[model samples]
Target: MRCHPLLPAWRAAARCLGALALLGAAVVARGQGVGAGVGGEAEIAAVGAQVQQLARDSAGRAGLRDARIEVEVGQLDPRLKLAPCQRIEPYLPPGLPVWGRTRIGLKCTQGPKPWNVTLPVTVHVYARSLVTQAALAAGTTLAPEHFTEAEVDLAAAPGLPIGQPGLAVGRTLARPLAAGSALRAADLKARQFFAAGETVRVVAGGPGWQVVTEAEAMNPGLEGQTVRVRTESGRLLQGRPVGDRQVEVML
Candidate 1:
């Protein structure tokens, strides 16, 4: 009897093939143990779009017009194994608030695993606002030539920008305003109607009887505000201003 010379070579080839099969099985088992996570560009877009739309829908209420909304989303945990989501809902977290920097919520539903997450968002409201063209003193009364209408990002600028030309026109600044500054309601004071020692018509009555008397204003006031006035008989009375120069009192 004699042994074939090729027998050893064939046996070695069989052993190599078995070893390769075992290595592949090990890789498959490890992959199954580690869960697959949802992430990357495509998934991010789907989630971000949902949040962006919610922002746009509420833009008008934020005083934003023709707004451009942009969003960025972070990746989920690599170890998470979320089932395929059929619906994704994004909204503001609880407080019904949206401003410069805010949070957006994401909820996934109609899937094997339902989950929620929060993302950071920045909102920019762009529109035409009245801003000072040059530095002006505290008492400087604003006019068309003093300021210019400029398109501004309201989120970055502190205080509300003057919305209309009529708002800033002929209005006295409450404090010194810098050049190219966004103007707010707090920046200016309304023109005074009743100044100290100024005589004003005071009408007091209701229903059927009316009495009109001339009195001196002890304190200056804006239209529709209360002012203390001194009458001819030395009576100090509080009255509600009904017009630009008139105050009314109920008897």
Candidate 2:
């Protein structure tokens, strides 16, 4: 028996409805995908704007009145199995433009991947011109020597006792000393007498007689006189004097 002609029309209508339903589903899926991509881009742009605003605020606080600035955001990693908006670009300070391609690692919720997304931006400022003009008008230049290290010698001469001016070795003497005469070191000598706030003594002269100390007292004793020296054991011994309060005793 032959099938009814109305059955063929019903079958055709069913096939058409199935195709239309699939087409509608595909259109809806494509729209959703496009919306998601656009949302991600909008989020990145919003982040970039926020970062730019912060940079502007900081520059204002830093006394930079005429600085131009910008901010960019992009993915740090692409192979990361995270959300599309998980990565972000870093904030770059205003400076001279860097030429050529450069890569920098960014911190993101996405897994680590180098140079996945990058942004290049240019910032120009009029402050540099003002600075250059000011430097030129001042007629000055900074040099490395301006920041160099310095040294001072504390052990050198002219480092004298407190409240006492240092006397030159050959100057300030009451009697002339011969050029080749040897003097004992100041620490090894002993004081024979004390007068006028100074120690007057005889220093070792070599074999025959003792040399007089060079220290000058305010009240000097007569030359070629005799003085009494009290030994460490409290014995008073007569000593022949030479100059100032200096004296020589028999060894």
Candidate 3:
């Protein structure tokens, strides 16, 4: 075979290009594998700190005065072989709250082989709330002396804790409350506005008309709660309590 005049030069250029490509691939492989100084635990810790900062930012915006925020990050997957990242950046996860149980995203944005992950994060937002000051019997209505306001971890509460001292002032306890116990929504029920089987006035009209009738309460119910009532003519209906002895039904 006859060789062209520029064949030798072309061969040299191709060989140089092939060597450079091989070197580039080797460098990327080294980075993707277990690079000595890169530690998964370290990355996890960095991600955790970032999550805590983000949680604190949320507390400030929420106007929750004197709130204490604590963040806990879960362990990373051991089977994940993430490339050693130059910068492990943190970002907020969509549709998740930063105050309670949530998740945070961490990514290697500037690394040779970029990667990302979602880790479980828990934020304990503590704030002041009212709690029982002494053991109270069930059915005992709350008074000013029943509880006092104190700082408590809202995240750990069984239900939403009473924030204002007056919120517990007139509600009756569902069960006996222990001294110094947090006051959750499950702990109390609103006082019965009217006695069961008692005759009460119900307004049964809406926008255009007003019809007043009498009803007998089948069970005790609180204001704003639905109660079963028997009409004067023996018709059964459900209505919302409007006052101490008033029920209102939608037309």
Candidate 4:
């Protein structure tokens, strides 16, 4: 018979089947172990409590309310030694929708060795409101017409300690300012006016004169002449010596 060839083929088939069986058994055992470890309700609850405390602490620091929070628990692993607070998500309060998300993680001491755990969490806060107030008129107080827009500064609102300056909330003006509106400090036009005791170059018909005056004025002097100056009632005497600032006029 042809038994030689058939024997080798049978042995190969048997070896393959045995290897598959071992692999299957190992897979099943590993799955069961994981399921059992996760099934410990008491340990999961304890870990959940720790996560809740972390959430509370973070919310307090952020000036958020506890009621506006939601917490979810994940399976605890023996390898996990760190806080999983990052997994928590807080609920938003009424009259407010989700604005943004913030993540936080912490670590607690369980024993000598530390385990790295992560908590995937989310925090929800109220949507900011916008309110605008415009500057009051000189004689009139603030009225509805004074405000042009309404908005709030969201970043500064959160995490504010009590008695600290609260968030700056307001709206922006929509339209251009009315004509003839009262001028603010920023609106005033700066004019450079001549001051007393300042030196000024005087140009007349001839030579340029440099005049240092104790008073403020554009003194009438000739271009190319030097003048002796005397001040009477903030005015320069016309008939004076020739110099830079003052010029002598021939009478």
Best by TM-score: 3
The parts of candidate 1 lying over 4 Å away from their true place are 1-49, 57-65, 69-97, 101-122, 156-159, 201-218, 222-226, 229-243, 248-251
Scored by CA lDDT, what does every candidate get? 0.60, 0.32, 0.63, 0.31
lDDT of 4 by residue, 110-224 (tens): 4344333332323222212222244433334223444332222222233311111121112122233343232222222222232334344332343554344333234334323
- Clashing residue pairs, backbone N/CA/C < 3 A, model 2: none
Global fold similarity of model 2 (TM-score): 0.24
- Alpha-carbon TM-score of each model against the true structure: 0.49, 0.24, 0.60, 0.21
lDDT head-to-head 2 vs 4, winner: 2
lDDT of 4: 0.31
* Models sorted by lDDT, best on top: 3, 1, 2, 4
Per-prediction RMSD in angstroms? Answer: 24.0, 36.2, 20.4, 30.6
lDDT of 2: 0.32
lDDT of 2 by residue, 68-155 (tens): 3443333323333323333343322234222112222222334344222223332211112100111111112322211211121111
Candidate 3 per-residue lDDT, tens place, 1-251, comes to 11112222223322322232233233333345554422355554554565455545544555442555565655445567777666655566667553456555666777778987665656565666777788888988888887776766666744557666666777788888788777877887755789898888988987889999888999886855789999978999889887878898896
Instruction: Give per-residue lDDT, candidate 3, residue 103.
Output: 55
Question: Of models 2 and 3, which has the larger lDDT?
Answer: 3
Clashing pairs in 3: none
Best by lDDT: 3
